[model samples]
Target: MDSGIICNNALITLIAIQNPVDRKAIERIKEMKNWQKKEFGQEIITLLRSL
Candidate 1:
Protein backbone atom coordinates (compact mmCIF):
# COMPACT_ATOMS: atom_id res chain seq x y z
CA MET A 1 0.00 0.00 0.00
CA ASP A 2 2.93 2.26 0.73
CA SER A 3 5.45 1.98 -2.04
CA GLY A 4 6.73 5.50 -1.51
CA ILE A 5 4.34 6.42 -4.37
CA ILE A 6 1.66 8.36 -2.58
CA CYS A 7 -1.91 7.61 -3.79
CA ASN A 8 -3.81 10.89 -3.50
CA ASN A 9 -6.83 9.42 -5.28
CA ALA A 10 -8.41 7.78 -2.21
CA LEU A 11 -7.76 10.48 0.35
CA ILE A 12 -9.41 13.13 -1.83
CA THR A 13 -12.61 11.11 -2.19
CA LEU A 14 -13.00 10.57 1.56
CA ILE A 15 -12.44 14.22 2.36
CA ALA A 16 -14.73 15.46 -0.43
CA ILE A 17 -17.58 13.21 0.70
CA GLN A 18 -17.10 14.53 4.21
CA ASN A 19 -16.85 18.16 3.10
CA PRO A 20 -18.19 19.57 -0.15
CA VAL A 21 -16.40 22.45 -1.90
CA ASP A 22 -15.84 24.13 -5.27
CA ARG A 23 -14.40 21.58 -7.73
CA LYS A 24 -12.42 23.91 -10.01
CA ALA A 25 -10.71 25.69 -7.13
CA ILE A 26 -9.74 22.47 -5.40
CA GLU A 27 -8.44 20.94 -8.61
CA ARG A 28 -6.08 23.84 -9.09
CA ILE A 29 -4.70 23.51 -5.60
CA LYS A 30 -4.33 19.75 -5.97
CA GLU A 31 -2.36 20.12 -9.18
CA MET A 32 -0.07 22.68 -7.61
CA LYS A 33 0.55 20.49 -4.60
CA ASN A 34 1.06 17.42 -6.79
CA TRP A 35 3.86 19.22 -8.57
CA GLN A 36 5.52 19.86 -5.24
CA LYS A 37 5.52 16.26 -3.98
CA LYS A 38 3.44 13.04 -3.94
CA GLU A 39 3.86 12.53 -0.22
CA PHE A 40 1.01 11.62 2.17
CA GLY A 41 -0.11 15.22 2.10
CA GLN A 42 -0.49 15.12 -1.66
CA GLU A 43 -2.75 12.06 -1.33
CA ILE A 44 -5.34 14.21 0.40
CA ILE A 45 -5.21 16.66 -2.46
CA THR A 46 -5.63 13.87 -4.99
CA LEU A 47 -8.72 12.65 -3.21
CA LEU A 48 -10.25 16.08 -3.47
CA ARG A 49 -9.63 16.19 -7.20
CA SER A 50 -11.27 12.79 -7.64
CA LEU A 51 -14.48 14.17 -6.21
Candidate 2:
Protein backbone atom coordinates (compact mmCIF):
# COMPACT_ATOMS: atom_id res chain seq x y z
CA MET A 1 0.00 0.00 0.00
CA ASP A 2 2.75 2.41 0.94
CA SER A 3 4.75 1.59 -2.16
CA GLY A 4 1.70 2.08 -4.34
CA ILE A 5 1.18 5.53 -2.86
CA ILE A 6 4.82 6.39 -3.41
CA CYS A 7 4.68 5.26 -7.02
CA ASN A 8 1.52 7.25 -7.61
CA ASN A 9 3.04 10.37 -6.09
CA ALA A 10 6.24 9.92 -8.06
CA LEU A 11 4.25 9.74 -11.27
CA ILE A 12 2.42 12.91 -10.37
CA THR A 13 5.66 14.73 -9.60
CA LEU A 14 7.26 13.56 -12.82
CA ILE A 15 4.25 14.79 -14.75
CA ALA A 16 4.46 18.16 -13.03
CA ILE A 17 8.12 18.50 -14.00
CA GLN A 18 7.52 17.63 -17.66
CA ASN A 19 4.93 18.46 -20.32
CA PRO A 20 1.56 16.72 -19.83
CA VAL A 21 1.71 14.84 -23.14
CA ASP A 22 5.26 13.73 -22.56
CA ARG A 23 4.33 12.52 -19.11
CA LYS A 24 1.58 10.26 -20.44
CA ALA A 25 3.88 8.93 -23.16
CA ILE A 26 6.58 8.15 -20.65
CA GLU A 27 4.16 6.45 -18.28
CA ARG A 28 2.83 4.29 -21.09
CA ILE A 29 6.32 3.28 -22.19
CA LYS A 30 7.27 2.39 -18.66
CA GLU A 31 4.12 0.31 -18.25
CA MET A 32 4.72 -1.57 -21.50
CA LYS A 33 8.26 -2.39 -20.33
CA ASN A 34 6.88 -3.59 -16.93
CA TRP A 35 9.17 -1.37 -14.94
CA GLN A 36 8.60 -0.34 -11.35
CA LYS A 37 9.03 3.33 -10.47
CA LYS A 38 12.57 2.90 -9.17
CA GLU A 39 13.73 0.99 -12.23
CA PHE A 40 12.02 3.52 -14.49
CA GLY A 41 13.82 6.34 -12.73
CA GLN A 42 17.14 4.56 -13.08
CA GLU A 43 16.54 4.12 -16.79
CA ILE A 44 15.89 7.84 -17.10
CA ILE A 45 19.13 8.63 -15.30
CA THR A 46 21.10 6.27 -17.53
CA LEU A 47 19.62 7.80 -20.67
CA LEU A 48 20.33 11.32 -19.45
CA ARG A 49 23.92 10.40 -18.65
CA SER A 50 24.46 9.27 -22.22
CA LEU A 51 23.32 12.66 -23.54
Candidate 3:
Protein backbone atom coordinates (compact mmCIF):
# COMPACT_ATOMS: atom_id res chain seq x y z
CA MET A 1 0.00 0.00 0.00
CA ASP A 2 2.86 2.33 0.76
CA SER A 3 4.41 1.75 -2.62
CA GLY A 4 1.07 2.24 -4.29
CA ILE A 5 0.69 5.62 -2.66
CA ILE A 6 4.20 6.59 -3.59
CA CYS A 7 3.71 5.60 -7.20
CA ASN A 8 0.41 7.45 -7.42
CA ASN A 9 1.88 10.59 -5.94
CA ALA A 10 4.87 10.34 -8.20
CA LEU A 11 2.65 10.11 -11.24
CA ILE A 12 0.65 13.16 -10.16
CA THR A 13 3.83 15.11 -9.61
CA LEU A 14 5.29 14.04 -12.93
CA ILE A 15 2.17 15.01 -14.84
CA ALA A 16 1.84 18.36 -13.11
CA ILE A 17 5.46 19.15 -13.87
CA GLN A 18 4.78 18.42 -17.52
CA ASN A 19 2.04 21.10 -17.66
CA PRO A 20 -0.88 18.61 -17.51
CA VAL A 21 -1.41 18.60 -21.31
CA ASP A 22 1.33 16.17 -22.18
CA ARG A 23 -1.02 13.63 -20.67
CA LYS A 24 -0.59 11.87 -23.99
CA ALA A 25 2.70 10.69 -22.67
CA ILE A 26 0.86 9.09 -19.83
CA GLU A 27 -1.51 7.41 -22.25
CA ARG A 28 1.35 6.24 -24.39
CA ILE A 29 2.86 4.83 -21.28
CA LYS A 30 -0.30 2.85 -20.57
CA GLU A 31 -0.29 1.47 -24.10
CA MET A 32 3.29 0.28 -23.95
CA LYS A 33 3.69 -3.49 -24.01
CA ASN A 34 4.38 -5.13 -20.68
CA TRP A 35 3.85 -1.88 -18.82
CA GLN A 36 2.78 -3.66 -15.67
CA LYS A 37 6.24 -5.04 -15.12
CA LYS A 38 7.91 -1.66 -14.89
CA GLU A 39 8.75 0.06 -11.63
CA PHE A 40 7.08 3.43 -11.16
CA GLY A 41 10.41 5.24 -11.15
CA GLN A 42 11.60 3.32 -14.18
CA GLU A 43 8.47 4.14 -16.14
CA ILE A 44 8.69 7.83 -15.25
CA ILE A 45 12.35 7.91 -16.25
CA THR A 46 11.65 6.25 -19.58
CA LEU A 47 8.82 8.67 -20.39
CA LEU A 48 10.85 11.74 -19.44
CA ARG A 49 13.89 10.57 -21.38
CA SER A 50 11.78 10.17 -24.49
CA LEU A 51 10.40 13.69 -24.17
In terms of TM-score, the best-performing candidate is 3
Better by TM-score, candidate 2 or 1: 2
Evaluate all candidate structures by whole-model CA lDDT and list the values in order. Answer: 0.47, 0.49, 0.49
- Show model 3 residue runs off by greater than 4 Å: 1-7, 22-51
lDDT of 2: 0.49
Any runs in candidate 1 off by more than 4 Å, and if so which? Answer: 1-7, 20-51
Encode model 3's per-residue lDDT on 1-51: one tens digit a residue: 676544566655655475322335555544333443243435655666776
Name every residue pair that clashes in candidate 2.
none
State the displacement of the C-alpha of residue 8, model 3, in Å, after optimal TM-score superposition: 0.2
* lDDT by residue (tens digit), candidate 2, 9-50: 666466446533433455654432345533555555455446
Cα RMSDs, all models? 7.4, 10.9, 9.8
TM-score of 3: 0.29
Error of 1 at 30 (Å): 20
* TM-score, structure 2 vs. true: 0.28
Ranking by lDDT: 3, 2, 1
For residues 10-34, could you state the per-residue lDDT of candidate 1 as single tens digits? Answer: 6545545554244444454443355
